[model samples]
Target chain A: MRPFTVHTGTAAPLRRSNVDTDQIIPARFCVRSTRSGHADSLFADWRDDPGFVLNRPGHRGATVLVAGNDFGIGSSREYAVWALQDYGFRAVIAPRYGDIFRENSLLNGLLTVTVPIEAVEEIWAAVEADPAEPVTVDLERLQVRCAGNVTAFDLDPDVRERLLHGLDAIAMTLREEELIVRYEASRHPALPTTR
Target chain B: MGSTLAQKVWDSHVVHRVATGSDLIYVDLHLLHEVNTPQAFDGLRAAGRGVRRPDLTLGTEDHNTPTIGIDRPIRDLDGRRQSELMRRNCAEFGIPLHRLGDPGQGIVHVIGPEQGLSRPGMTIVCCDSHTTTHGAFGALAFGIGASQVEHVLATQTLQLRRFKDLDITVTGRLPDGVTAKDLVLALIATIGTAGGQGHVIEYRGAAVADLSMESRMTLCNMSVEAGARAGMVAPDATTLAYLRGRPGVPQGAAWDAAVRGWTALRSDPDARFDTSVVIDGAALHPYVSWGTNPAQSVPIGGRVPAPADFADPEESAAARRALDYMALQPGTPMRDVPIDTVFVGSCTNSRIEDLRATADVLRGRRVADGLHMMIVAGSAAVRRQAVAEGLDRVFAEAGADFRAAAGCSMCAALNEDRLQPGQRAASTTNRNFEGRQGKGARTHIVSPPVAAATAIAGRLAAPADL
Candidate 1:
């Protein structure tokens, strides 16, 4: 995981809303056991069209994705988040996101910025107007700036702190192993088990 | 203050309150499948950590397994490798796994309850989003990503924020043709795709209480479609009856003590929620999706909605896109929408009761000429049960293709069973998102009976229409 303090990159605007994980890296690509080779598979179906946003010459090297509402709306696959990072995307800005997708992004250090629908439209306009214009997503300031217009975004405090530190949450939880053992002994007696 | 069922379960699992503003809660069970778990194993190996509680974690191969040919090697190279890797990984970690040929092998969500592993007041997590199906037993079950899967495997805990409680109380008896699948579809249609985001829903009132355990699982399975992480029903007589003789359940005096606590898992009479919604169950009909997402649905008798029907510009635009992708015309009767295939199985509705009810509808009917209908069980165990009940003969007699093996066939089409380009299906699967069944495949999400009737009618027709 990489610490996400601030990032500035060219933004690519996805006009469609409710882009699900199945569409993000289709089920076919999901078979690959490794996570690093998914860059080419991101939006594998849509990318076949020459006119797809990311396929355009100007949007070719973008590292920030500005999409519509309910982005990543289905599936709990972290492969979707891995595909974005594998494709060099540093941050994703959307008005709304699937609860699980947002959580996956936080753990992987891929920043997800949520703003009002109006602010998202503004960012979309700036990026669509000039694909070369770089947009700044500042985690420290809690704001997204594009085309001299600044719009603020909100991130959960719990997630924000971990992303800022690039923390491995597994290690943090392991530190409290004693507490976990104690908690287990007190679990409901009826809870089922496996041999 | 009175606590809701979700609140009680959630509070009971809390191990520590972090200064960083989230609760660190212990996980009682963690279910794993072939997809999205190989990376987690790799991470665990790299960090030199062993599974903290292998006994509490269970793995099963389902997503990429074939619904037919249980004896042959997996044909897809990538899928075969994934399956092999999973076997090796589980072996290395000393975790028990239900192999593809084993009777215990089935969809994780299905086997969890069947094995009596999902009990009230427990906290369960899986790599698949539909893990919420276990919440039907009054457990706080939800899905997680690979990183979280690894976290739970290593430390048996998760750090997360709390969710607001939403009470969805359905009144009156559900009409004959409208099953739990329809009820949830109607709910999602009323509340848009992201309606329940960040909330945990407790289904209350008469209609919910009347549903059987399988039906309750069907309702909770699609909670994610409404953007909710978990949906639950308090444990009661139906839940107890289903678990009484199942393996892994508490016995004798232990069971009595457990029942007392389970009975208390319900919401207090005066419990307050962040939001409350009441639904009229009698009014709902068999519902089906007209577009790519679950929320883009309407009753079987309704007509396709025009983009203009949506007041929000973004919504209208989305509707337009969905209509274009689905190749549907506005104002067309949903019953008249033709389909190329009909699928009657998925984690959502592939249990013995579902099979029996759908079989009753399909018993003497003939599948429309040239239209294909397929029925696959949620697990090998389910397939065996369906066979013994003669549901297979009924499906075959109805001119449908009843599969011999069991897996997530056609639902996800991850294992060579899928719709081709320009193909459309009336399926019982949870999602109707673009190409979910196959590349360029369009789907109308329906209940098992609706799928059966649609197959016989060669279109989207309910049993009542027949």
Candidate 2:
């Protein structure tokens, strides 16, 4: 996992609300042992239309995505986050996000910043007016900046600290393995029970 | 302050608490299936760590296994590989794998409670979203992502943030022909999808307490559809009776001790909740999703809602898009909407009771011409029970495809049981997300009786209409 602190990149504005994980990457494309190649399947169903924002010119290579409220609102699949990161998005700025999707993003090193809907709309307007404009997301400052407009965001301080240090969940969980073993032993106190 | 049931279970499971951070909570049972565990197992192998508690962990091949063909290899290549990987991983990790032909093999959520692994006062975590089904037994069960799955496999613990308590109180008796499915759908419709976000819902009041254990499971199972990770019903004599002689349940002295402990797991009379809502169960009709989301639903007999009915611009736009995708007219009655197929199995409603409910509606009647209806049992045990009761014969006689066993089937299009592009289906599955069944496929979520009646009519219909 890479530590995420500050990122500056072109922002892609997606004006759709309730953008579910199903549309992020369909279930048919979720197969495969490795997590790579998800970029090809990112928004695969919506890409056929030339007018779709991702397929339109000037949105290519954008690393920041500004989407409407309730983004990534279906399924517990982590593949949604994988596809976004694989598609070169370092961060997603939305008014709100699906709880599971937000957790997946944090665990996988993709930053998800939540702000007021008006703040999101401001970024959307700025990004839509000038596709080449770069947006900055600073975890240390807890703010998103674009075109002289800066809006503060809120993330749990613990999550921010972990993301800043590139600490993976498995390692953090393993640190408390002894305590877990003791707790388990206390709960089911018997011989090696085989089911 | 009297703690809620969720708080009781959560506090009891806390192994370690970090200052101003998440707590490390012990997982009493961890469930997994073919699709989600591959990456978790890979992570464990990469770390050179083995499963810490194989006895506490259980695996099953459901999402990718076929319901129709049990004697042969899975025809879908990806499905086969997933099932095979699950078998190998479980075997290597010393975790029990309920393989394709195993009696216990079924949808992870169904078999958990069926085998009594889902008991009161337990903290259960699974990789699938519908694991909330176990919460009906007074367990604190919820779903987690792949990384969390690996975390549990390695340490038998999960880092957690406790959720606020939301009590959904349903009063009054359910009207005839109305079921738990209708009640849950109505709740989701009233609250909208994200209404329960950040809260663990406890279904209470007269209506929820009156339901059977299976029906309670049905109600809790769809909590995820409403953005709630967990939903629980307090254990009582009903829950105890349902757990009496199941596979993993205790007996004699142990049974008495377990019952005593479970009896104390209910919320206090004066327990306070962050939020509470009351629903009139008697007023709920057979509900169905008319749009791409579970929250966008109407009663089976009601007319499709116009976009103008929504006051929010985002909701209105979503309604319009749903109308386009579902190919529905705003003012048309829901009964007039035709369906090409009907699916009668999923974790949401695919128990023995569900099959019997469908069979009751299908008996002495035939599926309408050009309509395809398939019924998959929730598990092999459910299948055997259905067959013994002659439900399979009734389905077969009614011209419905009666599958012998369990798997995800059409609930998720992980195998061959999928609808073609632009095809519409009346499904008992939870989600009606765009292309959830298949690409370009439209799903209208309904209950077992509604699904059966729709198949017979070749259109959306409730049991009363028959």
How many residue pairs in model 1 have overlapping backbones?
Answer: 0
Candidate 1: residue pairs that collide: none
Candidate 2 local lDDT, B56-119, one digit each (tens):
8988888867777678898877667777888899999999888878888888899888887888
The DockQ values of the predictions, listed in order, are 0.81, 0.52
Tens-digit per-residue lDDT, A9-28, candidate 1: 99999987889999998888
Worst 10 residues of 1 chain B by lDDT: B404-413
TM-score of chain B of 1: 0.99
On DockQ, the leading prediction is: 1
lDDT by residue (B1-466, candidate 1, tens digit) is 7999998999999999888668999999999999999999999999999999999999998898987787899999999999999999999999899999998999899999988899889999999999999999999999999999999989989999988888999999998888999999999998888988998889988999999999999999999999998999999999899888789787899888888989899998888899888999988888999999999999999999999999988889989999999999999999999988999888998899888988988988899999999888888888899899888899888888988777778877889898998999999999999989999999999999899889889999999888
DockQ class, candidate 2: medium
How well is each residue in A15-59 modelled by candidate 2, as lDDT tens digits? 888888888988776655555668988888888889888887989
User: Which candidate's TM-score is highest?
Assistant: 1
